[model samples]
Target: MSAFAERKEMIMTKKTAYEFAYITFAMFIISCSIYFFLIPSGIVVGSISGLSMVLNQVINLPISLITFILNIGLLVIGFIFIGKEFGAKTVYTSILLPVFLAIFEKICPLSESLTHNSVYDLVSYTLIIAFGQAMLFNVNASSGGLDIVGKIISKYTHLEIGKALTVCGMITAATSIFVYDISTMIVSLIGTYANGQAVDYFVGGFNKRKRICILSEHYEEIMKYIMEDMNRGVTIYSAVGGFDKTPRIEVVTIMTTSEYKKLLNYLHQSDYKAFVTVSTVNEVIGTWNINKNSRKSKQKEVSVQ
Candidate 1:
């Protein structure tokens, strides 16, 4: 192989290793929340784990075993319908979660609730599971089961993952009514909502970008710094100040949070009086760093690799 190819392969290998390590730790956190808090308290917060909890009550089977079986079935459906990428991304966490749960169960079995307070326990586990799932989702990985179904919903229906997961959770939470009392079902619904909120809260910051508009007397210097030093694109617009009605140049650019911080620091040092307006950008299209054709060709090359 060429030197470039070898280097690229090494980078990809390192990335994959890091991803698995992170996913493993996230799954372990989820498993601990399940075995320690949720299981003992009978709080079903909607997921394969929640469904397994309900089923285990009726069939008297191990929750870990039930989760394993359900995840396997979901994996098959995901592979056939959702495409190879989704299946491949989910395979590790889907399989590992049940293994972790089983190991935790064997090593440190829970006979009763840890705190003996159902409300606090449910909230604690909700936060823990939500954070773990957020970590997985941030990395474009999932804990599998209904998450695969959520992805299917998002892909075909164009629903957001959080909304799709909420829909799935509602269905699973409804089933909890049969296994537990109405009060338990209410708690499950609240926990489900909290879970979605926590995931959104944590995952939102990771992909969020800033859209910055700078009206500066030294627009040229700012633009030069952005284009040459920061290596980011900028769009200049001719504008008139509403108050003074004077024609001025408005520099606009979109950048990640880190880049925004750097640009803000530069503005403070160089042009402290620059009129800046920053807003959140949910998404960006096209290439930020390279030409369109080059980006398309690079994508194709990466796919081939």
Candidate 2:
């Protein structure tokens, strides 16, 4: 079997209670954000929120009710376009979201405007809710509205996620404009933009992209961190320093960003003269030696010997 297939198999088989907790927490966050912020503002942040706002206006239905009804069709579409894996994960998220929204709405009843200045108030709430919404999605949970719809578009239309989300947001926003207040439309647009940005920002820390760029006299020590401590594969690049003509050893490894930060700090502090540069990598397609057999098998063990 190909190495990629082995990694994929490992990911599929691995299960833990923490994953479930994150998923459920993500669902709850999205639901509460929708109920307290978007619904109260009559604004939509994306495809799902937009649809709920529009449907609620047209039929005078509760936003959560509309979300629940719409998700049924979107879920089917995801199954067709995105496959069973995404669809299966979305199933629990999709159901739990609307349930949380409905329950929160009934219990809290935060719909009454705290201030007459709904525009500013709307934006404030939208930004606040985006925080929670972003956190949930950062952990790979769905928002259960046109959210699944956006994913479906990405799967079937062969579009990138941002483009798919933008397209979905536009359609839903335009549809909503006819029925919602003008201020709501404006807030909806702001919410959509904010939602997208929030996802990109929070997902970085939450998803964990580990990268290392070492600038040090102690090339061996950096390599030790990469091999012994991190136990990840590394690529070494030889570079000449701009001012000194001295050759520098640059080691690059992919791990979680937190891990990367920790390693970077360690290298910098251990060698005060060390200059390190780091980047937030978008993706890292590799494995750490954490499996039962590999737990004690250091990369240094494999490479140094």
Candidate 2, TM-score vs. the true structure?
0.73
Residue range 3-46, candidate 1, lDDT tens digits? 44565667667777888899899999988888888888877788
Model 2: C-alpha RMSD to truth? Answer: 5.3
TM accuracy, model 1 = 0.82
List lDDT for all candidates, in order.
0.83, 0.64
lDDT of 1: 0.83
| Winning model by TM-score | 1
For model 2, what is the error of residue 66's alpha carbon versus the real structure, in angstroms, after optimal superposition? 6.5
Runs of candidate 2 with Cα error greater than 4 angstroms are 1-14, 44-46, 49-69, 105-107, 114-117, 154-163, 181-184, 204-210, 240-248, 268-270, 288-305
What shift in Å separates residue 109 of candidate 2 from its native position after superposition?
A: 3.9
The clash numbers for all candidates, in the given order, read 0, 2
